[model samples]
Target: MPTTIRYSISDLATYFESTTYDRIMVLCDENTRTHCLPLLTKWIPHFQIIEIASGETHKNWETCMQIWEALVANHFTRNSLLINVGGGVITDMGGFAASVYKRGIKCIQIPTSLLAMVDASIGAKTGIDFQDIKNTLGTFYEAELTIIDPIFLQTLDKRQIISGFAEMLKHGLIADKAYFHQLLDYSFENTIDWPLLIQQSLHIKSSIVAQDPTEKGLRKTLNFGHTIGHAIESYYLEKENALLHGEAILYGMIAALFLSSKKFNYTSAFISALENFTEKHLSTAKIKIDITQVMKYIQQDKKNKGDQFLFVLLDAENQILYDIPCSQNEIIEALNYLHD
Candidate 1:
């Protein structure tokens, strides 16, 4: 399952002009509708536009129903093409909707946000959060193509850019340490060269995904920071001042690093380097976990089996140790360590 990640819009324009579908429809959130869709409209003028509310909060069945209803009303057939033109939430929910609609439909991803462009849009893992759980219902439906235009990043605020940068950092940590060093060169103040950064992140992820598409083994490393990150993201969903996915992920990575040192005996210098780097880049929030409540979410995590919690831990060599069944007590201990 090698995902074709288009780097240049000129190349994408060439492809879009030559390609044709029965019915072309595009799904975008308010933000992307304002900022990014215009670029697509230039090349694809006749595509039907379906606008949805933005944010991770709207990623649910109700919104998905709206998408399905729209597709139904439009008389979309299997040959119809669905283009997702927003960040992670839009692509995730839209891909899920497009996949199940009429059993399946051809879909393409035009990832505007850095998060979507890098990780979410590449994997073809379509999902929507259910009952506050992250990505509860989903399918592995690959997009016919994925177009990544770094031009969209021009409108992004520092926080939005930083949000995506977390995943890139994770990619480096999980696979290539040298890539991690490359990431340290930029920040919210010092801008990044998006084309190169996006390509680097894509290569790391695609190479890993190429080995294991259905997450049977190696793909689990991608879930490194997510196990705890999703819990934090879910817990804060109802709050007014919620952290973005990457912000939450930074915390999860910190906790995971702590756990890695305790569980896998990861090198002390590497753990310290990661902690210092993360703390420097991400703002810390005083999220006082109920510890008990969060464990419930972890227990219900998709990676877990009956009464067992699965973690992807980093070992001394900086390689991932996936499918490590960790004890609840150990997790609690890690949580306590984080709290301290």
Candidate 2:
């Protein structure tokens, strides 16, 4: 049976106290090594540390090969534990490496970013993006445990925080109506109640993954704003520098909202609320979108089926997410709304 784990900052020591392993390897990026590892090392004394170059560009086969070589050279056997200690990129690649290494090994996730804690950490999906395509190469491997510590948010830049929050907002829009309304009441300036938000988002993802771990059915709901969001992210990432994951999703959410209103006849009031929430919280970074480039990227999206592009749009109350298909022209119109 699979074990369900709950992670909290205060419970870090207690969580690791009972764990038994011959050797432990901690994977971290530059930023995390400088800011997070010092604090983490005090608790986990009997562990070897490895640092990889930071950023999305480094997530590739070459990197994976390097990790594999290190494990082999160091004689890291199956009895060893791989502890992924960073954001999405670290967790995704680390989890993938551990899963493939030695056929399989126990891995744990200690996510630092809000995005990782709520979304990436919970899901078994792990992979590296190929070329410009997002998450093109990957696997479904759940970690033995996931440890979430909001205290690490102190080291994150404002942009990183906002990026993670977009996914959290996506959780609310897709499944929980009450959580959606509650988000409307909180501002980014205020400290988020981490425990409550983490539990709610975990519950949302856990329910979906429990029903469909392979993503054949209801797990599609979690892709609410990801369709167009990922395209925009890829397009801008290729054309420009400095666009964060959450920022790209912010624009993706805007395009999705427009699609929801147009196709679903979702009420104008609901639309206004979503737009207001976006403008107030999301930054205005103008991205030059060549309609052709965006269209090309969308064609390669993993969610695309046949000729139509599928999107997860919400109803008026924000309770149910309807999977709707849009033609090429409709997608262009939705992109225009981002410019407006």
Candidate achieving the largest lDDT: 1
TM-scores for every candidate against the unseen true structure: 0.95, 0.93
lDDT tens digits, residue span 155-223, model 2:
898778777877877788777767877877887678779778878878888888888888886898888
lDDT of 1 by residue, 92-168 (tens): 99889988998988887888889988899987799999888889999998987888889989988778888898899
Q: List the residue pairs that clash in candidate 1.
A: none
Off by over 4 Å in 1: none
Candidate 1's clash total is: 0
lDDT against the true structure, per candidate, is 0.84, 0.80
Off by over 4 Å in 2: 1-3, 9-17, 316-319
lDDT of 1 at 314: 89
Q: In angstroms, what RMSD does candidate 1 have relative to the true structure?
A: 1.6
The alpha-carbon deviation from the true structure for residue 60 of candidate 1, after best TM-score superposition, in angstroms, is 0.6
